[model samples]
Target: MKFNKKIFNLSAWITLLIAYVLPYQSQSSDGHSTYLGYPLSFLTINNTPIYKTLFMTESIDIFTLTIDILIVYFVMHFANVYLSKVKLNKGMNKTKDFK
Candidate 1:
């Protein structure tokens, strides 16, 4: 089968959107907090009470992001393969009936 750039692009964008949209927040006893998403952490906030001060930080977990992308890609690939096979089988059955 030929490669379709549009499908690839669309899947990649969707995967990224899902990865970023779903986030889990966790806070520690020491006033450290983190926002973890599927395969990566999106934000980290640290609170230090040194004369009333708050610090916020945000970073992307490259490792997890990479893993997330790979996982999504594989899932999409398998789904595409399964769908194509189903379509091909349907087409073949139609041809057999006509013959």
Candidate 2:
């Protein structure tokens, strides 16, 4: 079966959402970070997570999330375009060589 662009676009957006929104124990509880009085991304490096989850982190705003979603979608779309360009066969006269 042939692949379709919409399927890729949808899945790419979902993957981006997971990357930015999926909570990871990237930090520990010794320190604190805020995002409107709630926890945000952490800074995990070693076995001990290094950030507090509450009383120091900011809350999630939907507007910020919407913008992030759009940004992620565009990034994936552009990357797909770039890969397609790279996959094309060049027969001595590639389009990118022209000014």
Candidate 3:
């Protein structure tokens, strides 16, 4: 299999979609939401570095939320790229095995 730039691009786009589509919760009982690839929890809001303020405060900071989302998007994109490379490498190895 050949390395496809489109696949990497598609994965990035998907990551961005997921990051933005996931809702941000203001409290621990705001229902299900996701930021980046990890599920967001009101119970564990204190555990999040970016969400530490949510623990003490009821309001969400738009700036921090946006920055965190962007960070997560990049992390997911790079992870997708690396995984795709590994998959392509495995496919190439299998073809060689057949020969």
RMSD of each: 4.6, 9.8, 10.3
In model 1, where is the ten-residue run with the lowest total lDDT? Answer: 48-57
Please, what is the whole-model Cα lDDT of each candidate in the order they appear? Answer: 0.64, 0.48, 0.51
TM-score of each: 0.65, 0.39, 0.43
Best by TM-score: 1
lDDT value for candidate 3?
Answer: 0.51
- In model 1, the Cα lDDT at residue 5 comes to 63
Error of 1 at 76 (Å): 0.5
Q: Which prediction has the highest lDDT against the true structure? A: 1
Q: How would you order the candidates by TM-score, starting with the best?
A: 1, 3, 2
Tens digit per residue, CA lDDT, model 2, 1-99? 334568456854564456445554443466443222112232222322447553333345555455555555566677776776767646335666783
lDDT tens readout by residue for model 3, 1-99:
344456556554554455445644433345333333223321222334564565453334455545555555566667777998999999999999999
Better of 2 and 3 by lDDT: 3
Relative to the unseen true structure, what is the C-alpha lDDT of residue 28 in candidate 1, on a scale of 0 to 100?
A: 54
Model 1 superposed RMSD (Cα): 4.6
Number of backbone collisions per candidate: 0, 16, 1
